[model samples]
Target: MATSDLHMQLIAYDYVNDRKTDGGSLAKMASLIRQAREEAAETGALCILLDNGDTFQGTPVSDFLAKHPGTHPHPMVDALNALRYDAVGLGNHDLDYGLDYLGRCLAQFQAPVLCANLKTSALPMIMPHTIFQREVQTASGETISLRLGVVSAMPQLTASWNRHQLAGNADVEPAMPSLVRAVQEVRNQGADVVVALAHMGIATIDEGEDAQNEIVAIAGIPGIDAVVGGHTHLRFPGPDHNGVQGVDSETGLIGRVPTVMPGNSGSDLGVIDLRLHRPENALHPQVVSCTVQLRSVDGETPEDTEIAAVSEMAHDKTRAYLARPVAQLSNPMHSYFALARPSHVPALLAAAKRKAISEAIAGTELERLPLLAAVATPATGGFDGPENFVSLPAGELKRRHVAGLLPYANQVWAVKATGARLSGWLERSALLFNVLRPGDGDQMLVDPQVPGFRYDAIYGLTYEIDPTRAPRFDAAGKAISNEVGRVSDIRWQGKLVDPDQEFLVAVTNHRAGGGGVFRPFDDAEIVVKKAAPLDQALIDYLKNPDCHDIRTAAPWRFTPKLGVSAILHTAPEALEHLGDIPSLHPEPYGTTPEGFARLRLHL
Candidate 1:
């Protein structure tokens, strides 16, 4: 029988120890790597470790590194070097610190970093593709030579933030073509297996889907064996949407073509093993089997000592830096996740945006306009998670913490839409919830099953969603409902809104561009000019005292039929502000005293 050779053990997406507790995942990952390495050695197999991306910024450590640069070197890079990652891809979050910081972080890593889509003529070290060739001795003692080619592609949305640094030098335009060409070039150089390490997410037919996401779009191009993807942070055991299956290493389930994504923040390790069989022509070897394995970073094993030590050092350094009080706030600031409840953080943010938009347009042809402002809770905004919680010890609130609370640098934009258009936008937001049927369901106020997208809106006008009622509008802005849910108690000039009256509305650029799938405002008439450094408006608004009133209730209210049981779910912090509302509920079914009395009082 021909001697069988195993080319195996590929580890993917170990985001190790972010800014949180000294890299919770990093310490675990180090131990996992050590174990994997030992296992690979015992099995006479080669181990290649690849990190997909988002290593640079997530926790407080990343925050400190970005703000107070000289105090601490890039700790994430240091941890990755300790883990001895073979190659790393540049994710969009890595660029959050700006290009110069990204370069510094890259320099700190010993491993070769590849970002095929992100280019800089000035920096030759930032190569688009890397080719690694290894000569391995089989169990039968025959040496087999193999070449692996890796090319990386990041999402195009990063263009907005990376423009300054990546401009003129970084070419995101021809990314897929460049990736294809890079794979071809590597094949020409005799690479046996070509892998496209993509930093983009799984493609969807929705608005955010990038053209490069279609695996078939790049598949069938010459010499591509496997594609490693990231950015979306989804775990695909099989080749998702592309017939790829992750090789099961433990079960020896071979021949699976799975595109693997180890869950974000070093939660899991993706392992792919390839078995090589040499044919008559040594150059053209056959890939007999492919296997995938996933090792949890949170396993009970002891942490990797070296990585643990480095994470500890980073933790101590970050704690000390953030420990120094930065600023003091007269009122306590809190963050709560539940959307039904009122939160000081989102309320503060919304109030700030409202004031800024109001000031920006106060006397400029859009004065005294009723505007709705909204801000998303960055951490809990993802539709999952227990109530959003922000712990504020009674004292000075650091600017760093505040910045951490609102991390995304999204700008504020004002657009003018009609009452119908605005109602459609809220309806889209309501779609974030699961459609609940009346009489068969629990309280409507705190339906946890209701998706976060629906509860996320902080409105200038009060509104209620009738779960039983189908949407009145289609994805396009056309009326589909006759008399479903009402946007009642909407007082403009001390009275209900007239459908014919035009209202000036304000929202973030993310919202304006239909980020939350609210497409109605995309066609809204834009009034105020776009503000540069939009987050600056937020910062300025926060510093001003006149803008801090968050006690005002939303003008409208939902009056479901008697005994219909309306429930609202919001973060714990929101309870402080929303506690008095008759309609407010904690979550699921917990309702306030006011809610009970309101039903009785109104009935």
Candidate 2:
């Protein structure tokens, strides 16, 4: 059994929203773990529970702990130790809080923390591979000892993504070669079966050795038996990945290996069952067949008392800090119609980031150039469902509201970019919308495959997104040849932008560090790196009255197309704020069975 991308949700409660969410939390997933173990025991099988990384960060509880490092014994570690995980792998997000904090977490976890790709002489809490010997009874009533060799690797961009925390702390190696060597070492050590805990998503195309998401390629390695994959928050053996060329989506098989990528945030548990047999002439057990499936967690599932108990103290502490007021909201903010047009969520972020970049590059040659800010909404409705939209009422805003705005700990970065690069950046972002015809009706506005966080809009520029034109980039951010771009009529400071002119754009380090594999930063140099993350900057931005100019800014709009209409899905509560986006000409189109409110917008 495997769980990936838990994101430090040790409790079945949301401190940010102050409600008990059903499908997330370690306490909730702990129930599924127990049931899986019981089911395996009934068949006289040895069940080992493992977790892929992204385990140490995400929730308000983890944020509270990050502010005060030694306040508690690492809430995630307490829950993992209580559940008795066999082995844990590292994800890129697991190292966000800094190396010292990760070292403390590594010491607190009772299980072996495995990372074959990351190398560091400073911290010795990681191992390339580990072996677990367990005794299980076969169908023939024979008891035998099995050696389970576990190897783990994450994306090579780990250091880059968390650039401030990891440059001197560790060196993140490439996943493909690292895992291949680690698997060979495990085989040379006489392990019976090898399992790969890959902290990566499956790539549809065969990207070479250095690509970030390469589980499909990793599964083709020589000695691997079963693979657990993550980092894209996608599920395998399900409809989310239906028609990829090299994968058997229904069976979760890449080539002959059964690969499982459990959905993020404790949504599903990945179970890969292997039936093994030993021939009369063989000295060790051999796998006869393999199958993979996902078990989902719902509201009715019971929470494990032990795991719940392990998380309560820290939960209380986080809730106390969550109530502390950060600022007074001059206006309300909601992501309901962020995709339909510009919303206050991104606008507010742009204001904060732009001000920070201006101060950071003051008096420098970079400051003399045109200044702009590019930001994406984190709370757009995607795999997180309709409730994913940010909804902050006007009043005394608290830290919880800030958390709702931008949850990740992304630091600010100022990069030098040219007009050509900026245009490519906007075009890449325009890939979020599908091509719409002049007379097509009720078409989906955004692609389900494209995440909202990748759809960035530059705050200081005005452009038209031509959904009718082909995109210069694909879904994976790779360039497509001979295609007219989706973004056109690019203007900055009320003037047409020259392709050769320079500009300083403010963005989070995640983008500068290859979060979406953006090409603008391929050879770009960041002039400023903020020590304090944008979360802190946002708090300061909200308290000041000078930053209120972003309240009514609209960055980008669709190219005019008569008699065309499209459907945009948002939260049901979005109807209350329909007045905010008068330009979209939104009309109520009822609700989806999945609870998203559909708004028909004329293109």
Candidate 3:
């Protein structure tokens, strides 16, 4: 065949088939593959499709695979093999289901699985690199030989998991060295092109610096042509730092070296078109030009029909798994972000944190004092759907719903803080607040209208925040407000709290570790007490409550409207209720009430 007729198209993507439902995006992805294959066939070019990891975990299918080992089939593995993938890299999520399951998936895949980082006591089937040399005859009756070498590497953080099930031997620093050696071996075997199909994140930053020192350090070594990276979910355009576009078969920009990362979850496809040049004087071929293109998955084109079919099957399987009954609720409790501050979910979460912390400090010397304040961060937001309110109908609540609510599976922790320290914590939580500048048109980080992140903690002691006052702490954690936002009206158990006396504070592990935009609490001179899981506490608390109705109690009041003050108090009438048995009133608070918690304003 003529040199111009000989062409190879390399496509890479992270197919997250295990998590998404078959009928949704997964089906769309399958359709995309079919279309690509048809287009490639017409061009008389060989299309080499590759996956850069994250295939195993995320959705109900993964959960089913974990629970019922031999019963549920591996959806991702089957889908990849059906598409006839050229190669796949080992991802961190692949180890989530354990090494045995990963091994099973690898065995089932028809294509070669490449990984230089992962190690196992069991071997022979698992190889570091795979070299493919094929001679294809064109329609004009001319044959051309093409050689390709592919090697892969997983990230170093995979070692944090249980070693017994997944062996992530902590010698990942030697991956680049081994990869260079593998490239030499492939070259010796007459491979024309050497490709490092790495499951590593791209290192380049916009400031013209290689942020990932490891990848940059590896690119400095010789023989590796192109590095297809993953993990960080970043998108790179052309020849990055270290050299020219390495993988370019046409015009070798950046000294004939190219690096690419296609991002994650079938979001986009990384297409690399390379052209090779053969000089009359030299026997070895050189990469001339390399061009990279990003095709978005969310495009207008119709998806692959075959892949879509498989996705539908997987969706059916997932729906069947999620349909199983777990627990019954007596009352319908809605997880409404809008009503959290004025309703009971936040209070319930705070109560759970308080209970968990109280139990943790039961035998400790600090357990005697009354548990004063509890704060809980809403880990799951309604960004995808209804952030304000997620209502559960009166029926059996499946395990999926519970998992959806508390997705992180975080533990609760309690620490003792003085009244001043408690005030500091609240200030940190208020970091979600962004001061409205004049003529700003309401475009701020924290929306001034959204009440979710704005909700304050259910304090055991009464205190007030002057929104008009400036922040007390500067960026360096030093006191800067002078006397602004002072914590006045502070009372615990109807008595003024002493600023010198220490009080126990309840919070979740996420917030304690400086999550929820809170500052790092590691410097606090307080004892750290580990507590029970927050989700379990929520489940238990729900069962133990005499009334499932979420009611607002006294001392918890908010100024809903300006100039017109309203009191939030539990009413005799019950509102919107759901569940098997109506155990509690749905409407807990009254719009207007007399003699509720007093908040005297000085005008």
How do the predictions measure up, each by TM-score?
0.75, 0.97, 0.60
RMSD of 2: 1.7
lDDT of 2 by residue, 452-521 (tens): 9988999999998888778888776677899878898899878999999999889998988867756536
Candidates 1 and 3 compared: the better one by lDDT is 1
Q: Give a tens-digit lDDT track for model 1, residues 1-603.
A: 000000001112111211333222665666767777898888878777787777776655566556677745455666677767777777766765567777766777787888877766644667788889877777588887778778777766555334433556565644577788788788888888776777754443333333434443444456666656656544445333343332342342323343455655555666767777777756756667776556665445556666656666656666666555544566665544334344555666677677778878866767756677655544442322332345444456554555455544455667776776666566655544434455643434333323343344545665555545565544333455574542334445465666666776666655664544455243336566455344456556656544236645443344455344444443434545443445533233454432221111110
Model-by-model lDDT, in order? 0.55, 0.85, 0.51
Instruction: Say which candidate scores most in TM-score.
Output: 2
Q: Stretches of candidate 2 above 4 Å error?
A: 205-210, 520-524
Q: By the lDDT metric, which is better: model 2 or model 3?
A: 2
Candidate 3, residue 268: the lDDT equals 54
lDDT of 3: 0.51
For this target, which candidate reaches the highest lDDT against the unseen true structure? Answer: 2
